[model samples]
Target: MPYHEMDALHYVGPGWAVDDGFAAKVAAIVSSPGWVFDSFGYPQVRELLWEHADTVVWLDYSRSVIMPRVLRRSLRRTLLREPVFGGNRETLAGWFRRDHPAWWAWSQHAARRAAIHRLVHDPRFAHLRVIRFGAPEEADTWLYDLIHR
Candidate 1:
């Protein structure tokens, strides 16, 4: 399912933190076998999901690749006033804010990549199959292989 669909169902808004019950809700949903969960590095629920996950795919694209996509998406959302997760909409004014997706991507990209690198290397998560994609084409190829296989 899409992230927005999950957020809407769980009553969580798009932001740095998930809502009060978000983690618990996610934990419950992912606790069941054969469920796939996607998150933007939600540390609060990482361990919980990791415990049940068999595979973790990280889109470890470089800042140069990510920034352009993020900027384009954010600009489109802001310009079109697209409603995002949980009825939240991006505004042109919000684009200038510190919390904007573009700014967040620019500032946190490296740190986030480093953290994921650490996570994949961590002994505690060694049981999980981790796949890291450095580019969009790689991710596409992975998906194609996954589907064809």
Candidate 2:
């Protein structure tokens, strides 16, 4: 779902058949070959995506590293009034909200890391090839090598 739709959903709440439709969209995407996702994280679609995915690239960065980057990105987007997902722009007030990416990143860092770690080791997902990068440099190097290869 787009950020605007998600924002609207936060206000209107669920039970609108949006999630069901999103699941169908996810299913369709995963059924195809050679697709990529910035994230396939929503609980409604995670299972299907994970089950079909052959590889997982996990970025396990420290909160100190993550919080600053999120804050900077959010601030830049908010200040410039840049249209983000689905033409939604970040607002300064939204920055304070618990659901804001910056806040959410900081607050959920540990829990999210732990959760991903559990998923990485879970027997159900053992077929997946998981490549975990603890720093930006590591990820960049991997991408560089991948591209050069």
Residue range 96-130, candidate 1, lDDT tens digits: 88878899889988888787787778888889998
- Model 1 lDDT-worst window of ten: 1-10
* Residue 76 CA displacement from its true place in model 2, Å: 0.7
**TM per model?**
0.85, 0.84
Each candidate's clash count: 0, 0
Q: What is the clash tally of candidate 1?
A: 0
lDDT of 2 by residue, 1-149 (tens): 22213333222322222333566666777788766666637766666767988998898889888888988999999999976654477898887788799878888888888878888889999999999999999999999999999
**Candidate 2 backbone clash number:** 0
What is the alpha-carbon lDDT for the whole of candidate 1?
0.75
Model 2, C-alpha of 37: deviation from truth (Å): 0.9
